[model samples]
Target: MYNPVRRNRNIGTENQGFGQNNRLQISTPYGTLKSFYERIEKYQKEVRIINDHEFLFIEEETRENCHHTCTFDDLESIIKQIPKEDYGDLKFIILRQPKRKEEILSPV
Candidate 1:
């Protein structure tokens, strides 16, 4: 489960917003790009853009699933919400998803 208050406490003051220091820091695990999108749709009910290159996604508690997809329109909508700014280059900090036991056992 995603606990906003607890997550904030763990991240400390460093993670108050998406791009406070000219960087986009995503605090969730990074699964396959496809899974990432699916989780976003299922867990995140709302997506808010903080700046031209920074966005915040609030997610719901969900069981980990590998099957999921995010649409192009959905991504576009998110990009459009960000307020325009002259923030130089953009940086992303995404957590990598852990491999499942089944994946490790499956043959290539």
Candidate 2:
């Protein structure tokens, strides 16, 4: 009987697997934002987030990884996240918006 509404009632009987991990891995990136991990000055990261809602996680390596929104509107803040020391090591993005945009910053 192929019934989509039927729920499986089988319990206790189980097929075994070779390995299992019951703990969450903190190092792994989750949700919509990509994580940037490394050491950073604690309060400096906090100041950046206070100025912009677009700024998400901003913390040091011992505390947590930094996060920023990747959508078009907040992409500038994301670009600013790149550490100046690592500028040569990281690649830059060129978009056609101001990245083509000029001056008009508000909607009236």
Candidate 3:
């Protein structure tokens, strides 16, 4: 009756009750990014999946919470592309971006 697999599954289920939310939360040091959030912009957040290794979330409207990346490698280039004013506030929780089949195939 003492099955290791069963026990692990039960333990995992119980651990789920810990109220863990795996979403990323980023903050900036200089507040240059904060100014972008003052007025509402149309593109608040955009999530992009780079290849299969990493993902990123870009908050266009708000500078204070402008961007987040699941992994650094996936977003290094994208991060550089962001205006210096908005890069300071970036933070992230580990996650992968979902992509549409067509979007992935579309010519960039």
Off by over 4 Å in 2: 1-69, 92-108
The global C-alpha lDDT for each of the candidates, from Candidate 1 onward, is: 0.43, 0.36, 0.43
- CA error at residue 64 for candidate 1, angstroms: 13
For residues 45-95, what per-residue lDDT tens digits would candidate 3 score against the true structure? 445443333334443332353344344455556665666566454454233
Which candidate number has the best TM-score? 1
In each prediction, how many residue pairs overlap at the backbone (N, C-alpha, C within less than 3 A)? 1, 3, 6
Give the residue spans of candidate 3 off by over 4 A: 1-71, 96-108
The residue pairs that clash in candidate 3, if any, are: 24-93, 26-91, 27-89, 28-89, 33-63, 33-64
Estimate the TM-score for candidate 3: 0.21
Residue pair clashes in candidate 2: 97-100, 97-101, 98-101
1-108: candidate 2 lDDT, tens digit per residue:
889778554434463432355543334345535432221234223222322223333323232343332433465455577665544433323221110112243212
Deviation in Å, model 3, residue 108 alpha carbon: 23
Candidate 2 minimal-lDDT segment of 10 residues = 94-103
Q: Candidate order by TM-score, highest to lowest?
A: 1, 3, 2
Give the Å error, residue 105, model 2: 43
